[model samples]
Target chain A: MSNDKEWKRKLLRDMVVIRTFEETADKLTLRGKVAGGMHNSSGQEAVAVGTMSALDPKDVIATTHRSHHHTLAKGMDPKLVMAELFAKATGCSKGRGASMHLADVDNGNFGGNGIVGAGVGIAMGAAMGIKQLGHKKVSVGFVGDGGMNTGRTWEAINMAVVNKLPFICLVDNNQYAVETFIDRVTGGRDIAKRGAGFGLPSFTIDGQDVLKVNRYVKEARDRALAGEGPTLINALTYRYYGHNVGEKGQYRTQEEIADWRDNRDPIDRFSAQLISEGLLSQDEYVALHAEVTAQINAAVEFAEQSPYPDLSTIYEDVDSGLLGAKS
Target chain B: MSTQTETTRNTLPSYSEAFQQGVREEMYRNESIFILGTDLIERGGHFAQVRGIAQEFGLERVKDSPISEAAMVASGIGAGMYGCHPIIDLNFIDFSLGAMDEIINQAAKIRFMFGKPVPLVIRATSGVALGGAHHCNSLEVLFAHTPGLSVAVPSRAYDVKGLIKTALRAPDPVIFLMHKKLSGVRGEVGDENVLIPFGSAHTVQSGKDAAIITYGYTVVTAQKAAAKLAESGVSIEIIDLRTLYPLDEDAINETVKKFGRVVVADEAPLYGSITGDIASTATEENFKYLKGPIVRVGGIRAPISAHPQSAEAAIPTVESMINAVKKVLAY
Candidate 1:
């Protein structure tokens, strides 16, 4: 086991950073800083931080459109991410991929897909590459519960299991697909149970509990690396805001939001754990907030100063002509 | 005694044999290229096209899937997107609607989206010989209209071999459509050396009277119709536009200039047939080459009728095509 003090502080910092950055994005949206629709991962920070902490940085991970947390948790420079949201040339994808499709492939981040359930297949393919090269790395595909029912997801899952692939599907189940509650659309309340029927090894956990989520992620990663095949983990969490910044979701009432925010908020929960364990003082936690705020402000400044991509980017990448030359 | 006696070597198989042979060779050559479809294994494929493929390729690479059209296409896209080069068989073209999203949106867009092209082969066979409405339809025009996909309707075995070989090497996903009626129809094919370029169209027969232009199963029909017209003192040029999507518009234009009259025949509905596109384009741009208006022949825009008399009236036939040629001559 690692030192309780160091691990707890790290998890707390990650949760705060993720929450703060996304909140800043919401503010930017209000201020006309961002042009496109934004999918907020405000209430789902712990899953990203906890799962990423357990995996190796060299290991490849993929996500769907709502992928700010995954990118930030993987140690991307906040300034670059902010610049990307700003659609600046200095952004991570060189201002090409805005929020829904940000990518820093050189850092082992497969870009997020705008299409549902697309990344599940890609993750298996990446794992197959790792197998072909005889490497110890594994792949993690983080998708939402809405993507679980797609035919492509099933295709990838079946192939992953049959090939004995070293892949893990991190089910980021926030209990809503935009506005529809999970129960309204799906049969059962649990997504991990559905995964079990696919012949995948699975587990469900309190996704807001950073420490607990990290423990299971580590176990899954080790099992995958040893060629034990894929594992599906249904992360049980909640979202504080609507699907995007423009949403005013009337689906969930005030009572539910109040309860989840007060009791199960991951950042506050992790901080409490740190303080109770004598790892972080109250003043130290307060100071960490100030530092995170400064970082967000600096990121906003860099984004404001950055340039948009030139129009020629449209024709640059579609064809490399590797298969055969076109006449 | 003649001391200089030379022995000539003969080896290449016909085009269809080469395609059938290539599947076997490539399966043996690479472990990852899998051949999958519905009931293909027990039926030895719908037209015996993949007969003995499983025996030579083994069960792993040659697998039979359920009757789930969307699942098969989605899986093929998934597998191929990662690393596997999958050759998927849609038993009939009409059922392609079920998996259109997977085929059009996901499989075709990935290369352009991620800035890395995915190489996959999609094989389809379609027609109305059978009584099943689900099984009886000609929808090649649907795929030909999709932007990112490349499609081919090989009218002969030589084309089957060359195009399949070429399609296997295409980084962009391709649809290899073979008309069901032309399955066993044979011709001279190569063993392993032919590369049918995607946009190359061939003029099968040359004539000054008119050009009978078409593709897929209609090539043979047009040729038969041309033969009938030839005996009646009509010279008709039969042109086969093998590749559909990256259509050889240039060749079609040059041929139209040489032969001032043409009859565009197809198996799809006449309303939006690829024949309509060609005729409309030629009329708009190559009006100078026209000594007569282009005649269009195809299904009369209705579901294929299983009843023989009604079915005969539904889609275009050899006699109907000949009638169309006469109409073009009058024009």
Candidate 2:
């Protein structure tokens, strides 16, 4: 709330855009336009909008399969990204790359991977590249609590630490992996403490507060750029939707969802603070939501007009022609 | 740097030298190309294939990794997926299980699931040696079982070099099975940047009697049997299945029609082996072309033993290959 006018408005607009973007996608999916499922970051907008607000455009990001939030915040065209979800040719990856693998290399958006813990290695690789090129850019590996158990994640973390590579890993602990609660799945352990196990400094933050997430990420980014090794920011937030849009809510109680929605809502909490601090008007906030809807509508329109990919594209871009094993 | 002496150095080098040259060439060709694996640091590479590389390229380009083989392989896959051309060398075929997840799941499926081709080479040594059971065991069949993977087993120096270069240029994951036995084999390699694409076979010997099919180190064993069979007026055709996954099924059938008898020989166990697959498929598709039932020559189903006698017993010997040819001929 203390920030200057332009940045505050930019953050507010982006937050609204991300929220509206999710709702628009939900509607589109209902309309049969989006063939694949979307990972809704509806209630957790501040973590994405605020954390991404701190990073540089040239810096690379290694995101999970549910990566629309990171990609949108980082600057992929809404139309092309939507076209990708629709499996259309006009998408960034020519429709060959699906929802789980959206990428925009021009914007330093490394492709999202469906395999858990796979992106951690990519982030470490990017960090190594940073060292090789002597560039100031630090690679960010956005992981989830589910990925913490994968051996490859540990490999990436250890290598990054041993080499003192410039990187930041954001452990988005949404407190649940599918139906399993993090406390139960992780055996009552904190993800930040797990980072400390690898000897990397970890920051456990209130991810609901955009300012808190942004401040921590900026500090980590600055430290990495200064040659001070990797940092793991344990982002504590919750998802409004299920693990995916098609998730069956057989695990958690409606009571838990209600309590979180009522008490610690990210967007609602942030909006209240801004309104109370006189930084944003309630009427102006309503207008921002309307503007976000218009932007999303324009993107969907562009995507709908886009053509589908051809059959020839199936054989393209592969390095090897021996499609099957040569055993 | 070698372009000045390129013509002179372009002569047919041994498979080992050719392999070294291929990696050196790729590194020079692309700045993104780097090497990683165990035995790379104080020791050049575990197999001496990457020897003296560290002194030339230093530790960055020629990386030395810890004994954490799985992590090493996954990191290479990650780097390869991250838009870098990386060739990861596994110390031995036996140690490959350490990196199985990355090789099987991540590296292989990345392009298929995500539609981003992982341009990478996993160059490793396999097959029996006087070098004990651990050093032995050609598990190319295991990798060949996986989808979206290309397995290249080069017996000749020309193939060793050309295949490595081809693998580097490929967008899909390539498993280059370097036969430890054929490391010293040399031939007059061509002067051009040769590429022997997949889906073909090398008929080491052309004969009209019985056809014996094999690959990797067993190709030599099959050749030995063919040479002996030729002395008996029984012409034998040796089909070296250089690459295994996208198998040359057409070639196998065509050869079976010509010879009317086929025998599959391999160094690995018979069950679920490439040799078994070939034998079964040949029987089903080319049954009428059969002079006899397809007999397969392979090791017994068990882990390789350390004793030389047991190890020899575990492989498809030249004698066994000859015996297999006779049984097929009798049919």
Candidate with the greatest DockQ versus the true structure: 1
Candidate 1 pairs with clashing backbones:
B14-B189, B15-B157, B15-B158, B15-B189, B16-B157
Model 2, A139-174: lDDT tens digits are 888887888877777778888887788888887767
Compared with the true structure, what per-residue lDDT tens digits does model 1 show for residues A10-118? Answer: 8788888889999999889878787585788998999999989998988877788888888899888889888888777888777666787776655667767777777
Residues B1-331 of candidate 2 have per-residue lDDT tens digits of 6775756555657677778777777777787788877777677775567777778778778876756656666656656666677787887767888778778866776675455667778888888877776788778888888877789887887777767776777676788888887877766564336656675787888888888888888888888888887788888888887788667788899988888788888888787778888888888998887877888888788878878788888888878888888888887
Lowest summed-lDDT stretch of 10 residues in model 2 chain A?
Answer: A318-327
Indicate the residue-level lDDT of A153 in model 2. Answer: 79
The TM-score each candidate achieves on chain A is 0.95, 0.93
lDDT of 1 at B257: 83
Which DockQ-derived CAPRI band holds candidate 1? acceptable
TM-score of each: 0.87, 0.86
Off by over 4 Å in 2: A1-4, A27-36, A88-97, A133-136, A246-250, A273-279, A299-327, B1-15, B112-116, B128-137, B145-147, B182-200, B245-254, B276-295, B299-301, B306-308
| Model 1: residue A309 alpha-carbon error in angstroms | 4.1
